[model samples]
Target: MSTEERLIESARALLWERGYTGTSPKAIQQRAGAGQGSMYHHFSGKPDLALAAIRRTAEEMRAEAEEQFSAPGTAVDRIGAYLRRERDVLRGCPIGRLTQDPDVMADPVLRAPVDETLAWLRGRLAEVLEEGCERGELVGAPDPRAVAATIVATLQGGYVLARAADSVQPFEQAVAGLLDFLAARVPTDHE
Candidate 1:
C-alpha cells in the first residue's frame, strides 16, 4: 500500500484502540512503518490524520448498518439483525468510541464525522421504527426519534459497560434486554 494509505489505515486501528487523546503521532508512524517526514507529508498533524481515519471509519459503519436496514424482513427483524451482528464489542464502535474522547469532542472539524455518523445512524433507526409502527409491528407512543436515541445510547453505554467489566457479556445482555423490550412493544393482532 502507499505510505499515505498505510498511515491512515494504521492510524484508524490505533485511534479505535487508544482514542484520539491516547494515540500519539509517533505511535501511528511506527505502526504504519512510515518515516516522520512521510507522515507529515501526508498529514499536517495528528488531528488531521485522525480526522481522515474517523471519516473513513464512519463511512464503513454507515454502510454496514445500511446493509441490515435494507435487508429483507420486518423493521424489528432488520434492527435485531443489526444489533446481533458480530462485533468487537470490547473495542467498541470506532465512531461511538470517539464520543468519549475529550479531544475529538472539542474540535468541530475533528468531531463532525463522529457526530454526523451517530446522528445519521439514529435517524436510520428512527426511520425503521416509524416503518414498523406503520406496518403494525410496533405499538404505543410512536416516538421514533426518542426510541432511536435510546437504541444508540444503549449501544454506546453497552460498550462502556462491557469494557469496564472486560467481557462482551454486558453488551450481549443489553442487546437481549433491548430486543425483549422491543418485542413486548409488538402489537397483538387484535390491538
Candidate 2:
C-alpha cells in the first residue's frame, strides 16, 4: 500500500489498541514501516493522521451494522441479529474505546467522527423500531428513540463489563437480557 494508506491503517490499529495518548507517531511509523519524512509528507501531524483513521473506522463500523439493520426480518429479529453478531469481545469497540480517552474526548476535531457515528447508530436503531411498531409487529412497543439509546448504552456498557471481568460472558449475557426484553414486546400473532 501507499505510504499515506499505510499510515492511516497503522494509526487506526494503534489508536484502537492503545488510546490516543498511547499511540505515538513513532509507533505508527514503525508499525507502518514508513519513514518519518514519508509520514510527514502524507499527514500534517499525528492528529491529522488519527482523524483519517478514525473516520475510516467509523465508516467501516456503520457498514457492518447496516448489513444487519437492512437485512430482511422483523425489527426485533434484526436487532437480535445485530446484538448476537460475532465480535472480538475482549478487545472492546474501536470507536467506543475512544470515549474513554481524555485527549480524544477533549479535542473536538478528533471527537467529531466518533460522536456522529454513535448518533447515527442510535438514529438507525430507532428507525427500525419505529418501522416495526408501525407494522404492528412490535405492538405496544416503547418509544423508539429511548429504546435505541438504551440499546446503544447497553452494548457499550456490556463491553466495559466484559473487559473488566476479562471474559465475554458478560457481553453475551447483556445481549441475552436485551433480546429477552425485546421478545416480550413482540406481538403474539407475530411470534
Candidate 3:
C-alpha cells in the first residue's frame, strides 16, 4: 500500500483499539512504518489522519450493512440477518467504540463520520421497515423510525454487554432476544 493508505489503515486499527485520546501521531507513524515527514506530507496532522481513518471505517461499516440490507427477505428477516452476521463480537464495533471516546464526541470533525454513518444505518433500516409494511409483510403500521433506533441500540448495547462479560454469549443472546421480539411483532394469520 501507499504511505497514505498505510497511515490510514494504521490509524483505523489504533483508533479502534485505543480511542482518539490514546492514539498518538508517533504511535501511528510507528505502526504504519512511515516517518513523520511522510505522515505530515499526506495529512495536516494527527486529527486529519484520524478523520480519514474514521471516514474509511464509516464507509466500510455502511457497505457491510448495505450488503445485508440488500439481501432478499422480509424487513425483519433482513434485520435478523444483519444482527446474526459474523462479527468479532469480543472486539466490538469499530465505529460504535468511537462513541465512547470523549475526544471524538467533543470534536465535531471527528464525530461527523460516526454520526452520519449511524444515521444512515437507522434511516436505511427504517426504509426497509416501511417497505415491509407497504408489501403487507408487516400487518401492523409500526413506527419505522422507532424500530430502527431500537435495532441499532440493541446491537450496540449487545457489544457492550459482551465486552463487559468478556464473552460472546451475551451478544449472541441479545441478538437472539431481539430477533424473537421482532418475530413476535409480526402479525400471524390468526391475529
Q: How high is the lDDT of residue 19 in model 3?
A: 93
Residues 46-126, candidate 3: write the lDDT tens digits: 999999999999999999999989999888889888999999998999999999999999999999999999999999999
- lDDT of every predicted structure (CA atoms): 0.91, 0.94, 0.92
Question: How would you encode candidate 1's per-residue C-alpha lDDT over 1-191 as one tens digit per residue?
Answer: 99999999999999998998789999999999999999999899998999899999999999999999989888789999999999999888889888889999999999899989999999999999999888888888348999899999999999999999999999999999889888888876723
**What TM-score do all the candidates reach, one by one?**
0.95, 0.98, 0.96
Predict model 3's lDDT versus the native.
0.92
In the range 1-191, model 2's lDDT, one tens digit per residue, is 88899999999999989999999999999999999999999899999999999999999999999999999999998998999998988899999999999999999999999999999999999999999999888877779999999999999999999999999999999999999889989978786
Candidate 1 local lDDT, residue 38: 99
| Model 1 segments more than 4 A misplaced | none
Determine the backbone clash count of candidate 1.
0
What are the clashing pairs of model 2?
Answer: none
- Candidate 2, position 52, lDDT: 98
By TM-score, the best candidate is 2
Off by over 4 Å in 2: none
Lowest-lDDT window of 10 residues in candidate 3? 182-191
- Residue 90 lDDT in model 3? 89
Model 3, residue 184: distance off in Å is 1.3
